[model samples]
Target chain A: MTTPVLEARQLIKRFGGLVATDNLSMTVNPGELHAVIGPNGAGKTTLIGQLTGAIRPDGGDIFLHGRRITHMPTFRRSRLGLARSFQITSVFSEMTVLENVALAVQAHSGHSFRFWKPALRDPALREAAEQALDFIGLAPRRDEQVGNLSHGEQRQLEMAMALATKPRILLLDEPMAGMSQEETARMVAILGPLKKSVPILLIEHDMDAVFALADRISVLVYGRIIASGSPDAIRINPEVKAAYLGDDDA
Target chain B: MSMNRATAANMVLIALLLALPPLAGLMDGEFYIILVSRALILAIAAVSLNFILGFGGMVSFGQAAFIGIGAYVVGAGTMHAFEDGIEWLGNGYTQLALTVLFSAVAATVIGAISLRTKGVYFIMITLAFGQMLYFVAVGLEIYGGDDGLSLYQRSEMPGLPDLSDDRVLYYFSLGVLLLFLYLSHRVLHSRFGKVLTGCRLNEQRMAALGFPTYRYRLVAFVIAGVMTGIAGFLLANQTDFISPAMMHWTRSGDLIIMIVLGGIGTVFGPVYGALAFLLLEEFLSGIPVTIAGYRIGEYWQLIFGPVLILIILYARGGIYGFLQPRSNGK
Candidate 1:
């Protein structure tokens, strides 16, 4: 009944002569977990980049809550409650865990030019960081440097950082990437509760997590959305089976 | 990681540095306060380079330009102020500080423009700008052309103990170095510094999380320039001379070598590096024996390079890397 939280209509991206993204379109409603599955080099990462304002689409518009945000910079998009976890585990390796989340909190709060008073003493920032860390069960290791975190814990820290931005639409590019089976299960559990609160656009290769977590599924092959429906209907779509989802459908 | 511990650490460090010079005198006269002053001043300059190379991960080869700019500004300003041997700036030190400020401003403007490019491009562009400035100094017919401008007197610190005495100047330089170190440490510890570190570590991640990483990097570049500019100020006063020689690319290389030689990421490491570098320079020149009887004086840095390579190859993180044993790929 309400406008989708995010909408991309006829998005087209071309690099040199190669159309990395071709007429791709999707919409995520309020508090919906929409999973986008595609083969490697199918322009999935490129689509995410365009959505988060890293790359510009040659054509089409991206709308956030019915307002066009086609040409906004990445920081502005983030300020507007759009957050994305990088596919690669990118973090301030030299900084402590608290400092990492504290930065995200600082970003969401206001300008950080407050240089005289010590920032580490700001209880508000610390509390906000702790809340995010608590949500991801990373509160125990808050004092440790991020460089010392385990692969799974680092991924959790990434999600915690994104959550600290207080985003409305969370763009997750392969959250389970490089995770062992145990870590993957933990991520699924973590995303389960978050799925109820935020509209998540997930690009995942893990079929089990997608089937368990995604409210709706979109099959992208060769940069085109070939099928979109409930989990069962998407499973039976012949073209989706041929292009993708076939191997994972056990 | 509690705020209390961080504050305590800073307090202790500041206390230790402030008390160090007087204690050095207690040891013996060999700690010539003038040499201490020179060391402290160079450390301040090296700290500025540390901000760019260590924290921001930007390897700038133009810091010497900032140093030269600061030096020449003071030298030229003093000369112009004393036209036909007249009293210029009334008091020389105030004039020198203003010159340093001007150099800081120049560095900021230059850094803001050059930071737009990344990686090797950034290095080359900064080097290009430094070369241009170097040539500008070389081309200046007035103010001693190739020969450096000399001040009749080192800038005097007004309202303080007469800094003309060697020990007094050493103490003053000590105070300045400690102040710069504390300020630098504070800046790096602040939220501003944390975000800058974030930008350096993972710029894409910082951007995606709503930071204009480019703006942050530019701000960092400017801050480093300004800091280096101040060091340049002290240097001119210390040497009582200014020349195009200070701005050479090889000088920039020396600064890089200092930071890398000591350790890149460690805050205190560059200070140690500067001490080691200068001491090595003085010591090697003073060495009684030379292999094949060739002077190893200017070529000391050649030895320093191989030593740095050994450190880099053996200890990836430099001395701190050896001490801390950071868990990479964890």
Candidate 2:
């Protein structure tokens, strides 16, 4: 059996009196789209943070390809083929689209101590950035300043940046958040093919997209998963319906 | 192809600077050489300050302390050479090497601590360090304490052009500035420069991108310190004096003003800033008019103050920004 691309075993996180993540365990196998659906403040983001090494879990170990990385720093985790897109559209707005992606490519490629030659002129970096931008359908806007891009475009750029790192797994934190319906559809379209190439652990609120795209769905409520199964099983699970899917939405 | 306005302006500026020494010679204005040399030296310091402030997003309010550190290296070297007969310490090359070494150490210590904090806290901490250095200089009785030390001669570079000649000194200062400008251009466009710029714009994003940003910033800080220390070496040689006053917070403020007035992140901005600042000071302070029995020139800052505000308000990117064509607005 192939090892899971990512595995979080009994992760726990607490904030003062509140338990943000409680005994959360999940896995994304190779070539799988695992969608995590939860209500607001169900610790979805906190889970992503712990996986990315931005936050330390109170109890549990995270493994990437069977190698423990629970205590790795954020950057080291990224270098070890873990990439994440923020819940909010976090990007280097002052730079150009290509420049933003190039930086991500630069990060994974090698050390950035090249102090004489112009970074943008490097063919390897430029080509990789272009490919990532093209994959996200943002190649035409490559030279435009990020601040000038539309909100949806910036969200797409975030995906492109994560993609440029050539990660073994992608952690998407509400990639569709704040996107308009058209933009959401565009993002889903981008994700549909992307999941075939890299395993993705997606935290999202849009049910239709999740149901359509997710191979397996995990329904989280109050910082713990109530159900985890194939899309059909999750849709029919009685506990998921009562706790999260609500009869009307289900 | 037509050159852009900023490139054209930069070219013109370089040409004028190159021609200044010869032109001053033609006009027999030896005094102008000294004035312009002093301006160029300060411009070097301002450029180093901008390296961290503009490119790295480190607002170091105590940059003058590096300059003081550098100049004192020169002063201390000369003193030990002449008074104590520690001859090698007086060597210009040795002083330059020591200046680089000492300032790198200072920047590492200061940056390691300051970089942990952001915004106003960073500013305050740097200011505190600068003040500490200033007071330390004041308490050094062997170095003349608060009164300052007088060097008997300019640093003796055995194999190079003599720095004693004002014209030679002007050319030397200009050469150093050009070298730094070239280095700045190379470094800013390089991969390391991109990372540094990224840190300035969005440090969090940079960290997530697999960059250990604190290490990058600390390295930039050290490089900037070394550059400023070199400027201090020249400044001491130029004036033949060093004092605790060089490290005062106000001098550090002047460096920031020069960066802002010229262009914050632009390579040639600080040079323009230093020239504008010194020339304005000379011109405004020379106004012979008396306002109610007080010389107007003595209070030149009153007029200068309003002008700086107007520039900061109206000039979005300082003078260099104005030089660029509108389409390239940051």
Candidate 3:
């Protein structure tokens, strides 16, 4: 078995008395799409926060490629091939779509201390940004301002930016959260091939999308995982049905 | 289309500034040259402030402290030359070097502390630092304390044109202003500038993308301080005096106002703002009207305050936006 590309070992995070993440452990192996599903207020957001270095875990550790990164800064984590898209569609609104993706590309190319040549005009940055946008199917709107893009398109731009970082593992926080059915289908298409290139630890509430795309699904309930297994196995898990999935779905 | 309009206005403004000395001479308005030069020097300060405030989203209220630092560098050097018989301190090279060094040091220290806070706390802490400098200047009795220091001689530029002539000084100020404006243009388009701007738009997002935004903002703050310090160097030479009032908190407020009035983030906005502010001050204060048997000029702020309100209210992006409304969704 290959070493897991990303791992969370007994992670613990507390907000006052509420345990946001409680001894939660998980792993994503090479080229696997691992989806995490849970009901609202089940600590999914908190879990992603810890993975992305936005929240400090109260105890335990996280490792990227078997290297401990629990205490690293968010940017350092990103530099180490971890990229995340916000659940609420965060993009640079004032900048053009291409420029937005180019910034992510710039982050990976080298240090951005080069203070003379325009980043937009740089061939390497532009080509990589364009390729990411093309892959996310936003190539036609690359010149438009991100603020002017439709809600679904902005989410796609977010994906393009995350992809431009060329991450070893991607942490997507509800990339489909406010997207339409057609938009969701479009995103699934993008993610279908994306998982083949980089492993994904997806936190999403869309049940159908989860079952269709997840190689393995982890059911989180009140900060603890009740079960983690193959999508079909998770579907049959009685505890998951009791804690999260309702009787109709079961 | 709006970009072109802004570019045209910038070109016209620069042309007018370039032609001012000769034009003033023809009109026998020699005093106008000095007044415009003072505006140019202050414009440099405004541009520096805009770098952090408008672009980097770091509203530093202590900018006047850097200007004060630069001015005092010259003032102290000249004082030593006349009283202590230390001529080396009076050289332009030494004064310029000291201004850059001291301003960089002061900005680094202040920014390192101030950048730790955000929003109102940042503003207050910067204001506090400015007042700290102001008080320090007030306490120095040997350098005139509250009265201010008078420069017996301007710093001697060994290889450059003499600044003793008022016309030469005015042109010098114009040249420096042009240089800084160009430098700002270059920086705002650079790769580093893209990161700085991204931090301004959404810092958390920038960090998620792997840019250390705090370090970027700190560097921008220091750059602004060093530039404003150079303006302060020119300012002391322009006025032939330096005092605690140079770094007064109100002076910082005035710099922010200038940025807002001209157009906050636009490249030429500060120059437009500085010139407009000084022109307004001169025009409003000299209004020879006696309305209701009361001299209107003495209480010009009554009228001045409303004019600014109107500009801010109607001009969406300040005066530059007024000149060319930003084409939406570019």
Candidate 4:
């Protein structure tokens, strides 16, 4: 009965004629890894966008830590310990990996209005950034530009950037998409321990990864949740099997 | 590994530029002094534009409007003083300060209105606002209409070193420009600057993270305006005149060209660009182009067009771009 870290109630989003996220309602308790699984065009990303304030829902509300945050700006949400790792993996291409994390840490550490102190020389910001990189296993690529990094490394850096904000909840959109099995295994290994501290709302298409990692699974078909339960219950749900996980499992 | 090396190099560069104005006196090159002054003033304006256009991804084409605003403030302040001259610091210093302060306020007001729109709308709206000022300047009968208002007297300082000296003014202007450059660099390296860059790259992502990008962008626009407004103040002092020609869209285009030619988003790039642009103008002005023996003195812009096109085509990185090798890593 603890207050959920993220709670979405009857969220609806539309694009003129198309209903993207239709009547989707969900909740994530603290430290719970909740996976939202749906086929392509099932509005999972749209739902995620609505939750993260990138797109406003037509109807309903989203609350973070029992607070009405649906109308809040993204940075305010992040300042309040809600961080979202982009599905597309956004990072400063011209900057070093360490600089990327350092900037993120700096963004959250205190008032960024300090204009005199050169950011590169700041020890506190650097330490926090270094620690975040260390956690994401990108400490070695600290000086390398994010643009020069491999896709996997960029994804890791994205995670590090998100973690640097020191969030109570992490919203990840398809973290395992377009990754090799080896990369996925590494991500799973890294994420497994982090989930112990922070609640995660993972929207991933990778079923194998989802099955292996997610504590609870929710089935979304064209924006509506068909079922929500423990992994075993979700796998056996008839509505989920018929609507999403068919025989071929595409 | 030490940051001091970069700072040391910058200091050396600053010294070289600082020594140039003094050498103009030794060489008896008043025109050279004038040329460098114009370049520095324009560079100040262009550098300010780079903050919004280069760093913030706001491709503005009406920066000249701010310069125009500054010119008017100076002209109007001086006009007001002529009717009722001053007692203490004289009318001119008060006029100059009024111009700078009012130019900043005007820029803030304009930016508040203009930053609401984005993309092509932003571009067109800024252009429209600049053109609005252009018409207003043209219509003003109190000033000079097509012809700019001439200053009755140069700005005065009430203290030691007497501000009437040309070399003194040059040094003062140079000091101001360097101060601006330092402040600009500080802003770019700030956390606010990083987020601004982030907004440029992916505003949606920045918004999702928690920052209201519109407010940030508006603040950037205002900051850029104030910076450019300072340049405008210097510009009026340099010219000792004010006209509608200052806000013309072509002038704005020239500012854009300066940013691109120097290297957008690079520190001190606009300074190099403004100097190059003015030098090219000077070089072209000296050569009277007579195609098939027909004289063309004012038609030098035609020749400059081809050169700019060549630069755009070959040196995509601009002037600084040409200096730096492209590794294509990013």
Winning model by TM-score: 3
lDDT of 2 by residue, B1-330 (tens): 368888888899889988988888898987788899999999999999999998888999999999998999999999999999999999999999999999999999999999999999999999999999999999999999999999977888899989888778888999999999899989998999999999998887787889988889999999999999899999998998999998899999999999999999888899999999999999999999997999999999999999899998999788987897434434
Clashing pairs in 1: none
Chain B fold agreement for model 2, TM-score: 0.98
Candidate 2 Cα misplacement greater than 4 A, ranges: A180-182, A247-250, B325-330
RMSD values, in order shown: 3.5, 2.0, 1.6, 2.6
Sort every candidate by lDDT, greatest first.
Answer: 2, 3, 4, 1
User: iRMS of each prediction in angstroms?
Assistant: 2.5, 1.1, 1.3, 2.4
DockQ of all candidate complexes: 0.52, 0.74, 0.75, 0.51
The local lDDT score (0 to 100) that residue A8 gets in candidate 4 is 96
lDDT of 4 by residue, A6-123 (tens): 9999888999999988887899987789999988999988987887777878999999989998887767888899888888888877778987888778767766656566786789
Kindly list the per-residue Cα lDDT of model 3 for residues B137-180, writing each as its tens digit: 99999889999988898888998889878888898889989998
* Ranking of models by DockQ: 3, 2, 1, 4
lDDT of each: 0.80, 0.91, 0.91, 0.80
Better of 2 and 3 by DockQ: 3
Best by DockQ: 3
- How would you encode candidate 4's per-residue C-alpha lDDT over B17-114 as one tens digit per residue? 79887688788988787778888888889988998998899877788888887777777666756756633323556656665676667667777787
Runs off by more than 4 Å, candidate 4: B1-16, B86-93, B160-164, B326-330
User: lDDT (0-100) at residue B106 of candidate 1?
Assistant: 74
